[model samples]
Target chain A: MSRVCVPRDAATLAVGADAVAGAIAERGVEVVRTGSRGLVWLEPMIEVETVAGRIAYGPVMAKDLPGLFEADFLNGGEHLLRLGRPEDHPWLAGQTRITFARCGILDPASLDDYRAHGGFKGLERAREIGPAATIAAVTDSGLRGRGGAGFPAGIKWRTVAEAPGETKYIVCNADEGDSGTFADRMIMEGDPFTLLEGMAIAAFAVGASKGYVYSRSEYPHANATFGAAIETARSAGVLSDFDVELRVGAGAYVCGEETALLESLEGKRGQVRAKPPLPAHQGLFGKPTVVNNVLTLATTPWVLAKGGEAYAALGVGRSRGTQPIQLAGNVRYPGVYEAPFGLTLGEIVNDIGGGTASGRPVKAVQCGGPLGAYFPPSLFDTVYDYEAFAARDGLIGHGGVVVFDDTVDMAAQARFAFQFCALESCGKCTPCRIGSVRGAETMQRVMDGVDTEANLALITDLCETLKFGSLCALGGFTPYPVMSAINHWPEDFHVVRDI
Target chain B: MTSLEPWRPERGEEIIAGLTRLDGAVLPMFHALQGAFGHVPKETVAMIAHALNLSRAEVFGALSFYHDFRHEPPGARLVKICRAESCQAMGGEAASRFLLADLGIDWGETTPDGAVTVEPVYCLGLCAVSPAALVDGQPLGRVDGMLLVEAARA
Candidate 1:
C-alpha cells in the first residue's frame, strides 16, 4: 500500500499534495486525508508509518524536508520528539469536528481535495432540490449563526430570499473579533472553498448576483487564504457568474456588528447604524442584503448537501447541530472543539478542556465572545445551548469559553468589559458611548473602596440602561459581563466605606 | 524611469502623464507618492494636490482616515498587545503591566531607543490563546509575562 502524507498547513498541502503523490509513484499506498488533530501549535504535523505505529513530530516548517527522510520518519522510530497515533491523543479524540470537518484533512485550495472529502457534495445535492428545498434542509438542520449572534441561519436566509429588492447582496461577516474564537479563521485558512461554496449557496437562495466577504485585517493568513480561494473558485467557474469581492476591514471591533460591518464595507467609518431599515430592507449601497456570520455560511453547505433532518439530528434545545466551541484562557487544552450543543459547560470545561491550565479550580467560564456573560462555577452545570445560557443570564456568544482560575479578579474583569465597550463603541448611541466610560469610572470607584455599595448599584443600573437603550449589541450587550461579575462574585465588589 | 525632481510644476506634469496611461489614476497616484517616501512626504502630497487640482487638506483628510497611512516614521518594531475582551480575560492586565515595566513605555508609546513601540490593539483574532500579542504584525498566542519579555527582547 502506498501512503500519502499531507502537511497540516492547508495552503502548502494544497500545493504539495501533487508533489507528494508524484514522489510516492508506484509505492502504492492508499491516500487517506483525515481531519487535523487540532494541534495547531504543532502544525504542519505529519505522520508516517513504522513497525510500531504512526509517529508524529511537528511544527514541521517547509525547509525541514531533507532531514526528515534521514531521520527514518517512515518507520515511526523515536527521534527528538515523537507522538504516537494522533487520533489517540485525548485532545483529538475528545473533539467533535463538524464545521471544521475539512481542516487538516484536505489541501485547502484544491477543488479535488475538497470534492474527495465530501466538500461540494452538499452544493451539488442542494442544486438538485432547488432553493425551497435547500431552505427546508437548513431549517431542519437547526443551524444558528456561529459568529456569536446565535441567530437561526435558515430564518435569516428565508427573510433575505423573501425580501423585495431588484438587487440583493449576500454578505459574509468574516470580521471575527471575539477572543478565543478562531473557528472562522481556521475554516478560512484550512478550507476556504467550504466558505465560498456556502456563500454561493446563500447568494443563490437569496437571489443575490453579488457577494462580499468582509474579513478582518488582523487575520492576514485568513485574508490571503480566502483571497486565493476566491480566485481559485472563479477560475474553476464555481463563482464565475457571481460578483464576489473580499473586503478587508480596517481593524474595528464595532464593525463585527452586522449594520456596522455594512457601513465599513461602504468605505465609511466603522460606525453602528440605526436599525429598522435592517440590511434585509435596505443595505450595501441601498439594496436588500443578507449579512451572515462566517460560521452561519460555513454551516450552510452541510445543511443543503446532507438534507436538513440530517443536520438537525445533533444538538439539544433551541441550539441545534454542532458548535465549534473555542476553549481559551486558563484551560489546559486551549483549542477549538466542535460538539453538539447538548453538552454541559462543566463537561466541556472539566472533561474535554482538562480544566484550568494553572491546576486551579475553574472560578468562572466566560462563554461566547467578549460580550458574553461569565458563569460562576456554581453554574458549571449550565448546558451549552442558547436557552440554557439565557436562563442563567448568560449567552453562548460565539461559543468561546474562556476559563478563569482563582487568581482572576471579577471586579477587574467587569471593569475591562466597560473599558472595552468605551474603546470600541461606534459612538452613534449615547448609552454605549457615554455609559461605558461612566461605567468604567464607577467600577474603578468600587474597586478603590469609595462608596462601594453605591458604586456597585450605579454600575448595575448603568448596565441595565446600556442593555435597554443602546442601538446595537455593542451597547446592548455591554451589561452582560458587568452584571455577571457583580451577581456571581459579590465579594469582589465588597469594599470598606468610611465617613 | 520617471524623473525624481521635486518641483511642483515638473511633478504635476509627471502625475498628469502617469494618469494618461491608467484608467483610474487618482488612488494609484496617491499610493505611488506614499510608496516612494516612508510617509506621504509633504512635497509628494503637494505634487499630487497640484496634479489632481485638489486642495492639500482633501489629500490629508483621505490619508488620515486610513490607519495604514502614517504621517510619522514608525519605530523599529511594532508591539500590538491585545487589549480586547478575549486577551483581557486571559491575564492580559498582568501581561500589559509586565510589558510596560519591561519596555519602560505604556500603550501607544514608542521606546526612547526606537527599539519597540507598544500599542493597544482591540483584537488580533488569536482569542483561542488569550493574552495574545502581535510583534510587527506576527501574532503570538498564550503570551504571559515571560513571553512578553522574551518577545520584547527578541
Candidate 2:
C-alpha cells in the first residue's frame, strides 16, 4: 500500500485537511495524519512517500482528490498542485529550525516516532550532566524568553533552582492569544514531546517534580492533540518522575503574562500582580516556580543536544538561536519562518513574505502582537533582534509580523490599539484600565476632527502614563501601536480636521 | 453537540462535586457545567461556592472575569468572528458587517428565533488564512459572510 500523509493541524483542518484525508483514505490508501509544516498558504498540504523522498502537494481540498488519484499523486506523479519536495522549498530550506525540527515531520502521539526524530535526547543529556551543568548549558546558550519579555531563561531557572522551597513548579505559558502569532500553538500541536522534554529538563535543573501547561480554551484542537501526547509520554514512563498537567485557560488574553497566569491557575481572576516577588520566587500557590514560554521551553532540548556554544553561534547580539517568525495577515505567502535574529524587517516582510496579498503596496507591518509597534516601510531597515526593536519602540513579541496594504486606515488602527487594551486589561491598575478607555475615546475624538490637536496631545500624555504606571506589558506596550500610527502617519489623524 | 440538557440543580451539584478534588476546581467546574447545560446558569454560583467552601462572591467574580463563561443560554448555534488585526487586514470588518446585517443582529446578540448567536473573538491563530471563524467549535478559514452564514445554518 502506498503511504500518504495529511496534516491534522487546526489551521489545515479549518481549510479542509480532514476532508482531503478522508477522501484519500476511502480510496484504500494508507493515510498518516501529521502536524503542519507551517507553510499555511499551502496547508492541507499532503505528501507521498516515494523511493526518492517525500513529495509535496497542497491547499488540497476534497474535491481535488479524484483528479489527484487520476494523476497518480499517490506515487508522486505529475500534478498542478505538486510543490515537489518540501525541504527544497525556499521557505522550509531557509529556516534554521532548532525548536521546530521535528514538527510536522512525525506523528505527535507516537512516542516511537518522537524518539526516532531525536526527541528526549536533551532530558537524557541533562540527567547525565546533572542539574547545575544543565543550568550552565542554558545560560551559556544565550537563549532568552521568546514570549515578548526577552528575559534570560537560564537566569529564571537558576533563581527557582536556588530559591529555598521544598516544592517548586514548572509552568509552561501556552496561553497564545496573540492574533498574528501561532508558533506556540503549532509547537504544542506538532511536537508536544519537545515541550515535555524541555519542561522535564527544567524540572531536573530546579528540583521541581510538577509541571503545568496553561493553554487557551480557544485552541480546543491543540489542547486535545497535546493532551494525547502527554498521556502517551506518561504511559511510556517518559514522564514517570515529573508529573505534568494541562490546564485550560478561560478566554483571558491577560493570562498570557506569567504572574497573571499563575493567579488564574490557582482559580482566581486573571489579574496582574506587582513585581519584586517575581514568579520565580512566589508563584502558583506561592511556591517557587520556573515559568517559561512554550518556545523558550521547547528550544531547551536543542540547546542541550548540541553544546550551548554551538547554539549561541547561530544568532546576533543578545538574541541567540533561531526565532520562528510568523508571517501573517495581508501577506502573500504567510507562514512560520525560523531564522537567525539578524534578518531585517524588510527582508522578512518583503522577500520572505512576498509583500501584501492584496497586490497593493505594503503600508505598515505590525511586529510582535497587538502591543507591538506599527512600522511603515521607511523603518523596515531595523533588524529583528529584541534590542533593535526596542530601540525603534517596537517589540519582536512572540515573533508575529502582521502586514497591511496601502488601504489601511492608521487612525482607526490607532483607536483599536487603545480599544484592545481597554477590553483585555486586568483592571488591576488604574493607568491601564482608565487610560485605555480614555485613550480610545480621545483617539475617536481626534479622528472625528473635534479639537484634533488637543485630543492628539491628550493621547500622547495618556500613553506616557500608561507606559510608566501600568503593571504589565498589556498597558506598558499598548502605546507602541497608538503612537507609532500618529508619528508615522500624522496625515491619517488630520483626515477630517476642522475646516 | 448543539442541543444541551436543561439546567438542573442535582446535575450541577454532581458536576461541582466531581471537580472539587482538583487544585483549582472553579474554572474546570464552570467548564463542566457549561458543557452539560448550554451555559453556566446563574444559580451555579452558590452551588459551586458551597461545594468548594468559598464565598459566592469569589465564585461570581472568577466567573465574570473570563470571557468564556456565559451567563445565559445562547441560540441553538453559535458563530464567533475574529476581531483581531490579522483578520481585520483581510477585510474581516466588511465580512462581519455583512454577516450582522444579513442576520439582523449585532455583535453578541442572537436572532429572534434563537437559531444563531454571534460573538466577536480576538484571534483563532489561523492568521495565514485570514478572515477566520468558529461555528460551534468548528474552525473555518478564508471565510466570507456567506461562508459563515452557511456554516452557522448547517
> Looking at model 1, how many pairs of residues clash?
12
lDDT of 2 by residue, A340-455 (tens): 99999999999999999999999999999899999999998999999999999889999999999999999999999999999999999999999999999999899888999989
In model 2, which regions exceed 4 Å deviation? A497-499
Please give the lDDT score at residue A432 for candidate 2: 95
TM-score of chain B of each: 0.69, 0.96
Where does the lowest 10-residue lDDT sum fall in candidate 2 chain A?
A490-499
lDDT of 1: 0.74
List DockQ, one per candidate, in order: 0.30, 0.84
The numbered model that scores best in TM-score is 2
Worst 10 residues of 1 chain B by lDDT: B1-10
lDDT tens per residue, model 2, B1-154: 5668888899888889898888878888888898889789989999988988999999999999999889888898888889999999999999888889888999999999999999899998888889898888888999988888788778
TM-scores for all candidates: the values are 0.85, 0.99
Q: Tell me candidate 1's fraction of native contacts, as a decimal between 0 and 1.
A: 0.37
DockQ of 2: 0.84
- Per-residue CA lDDT of model 1 for B1-154, tens digit only, reads 1222333446544654575343224344544543343235555556656666667776555444444444554467777787765676567878889989988887777789977777777767666556777776566766788888887778
- Among these predictions, the greatest DockQ belongs to 2
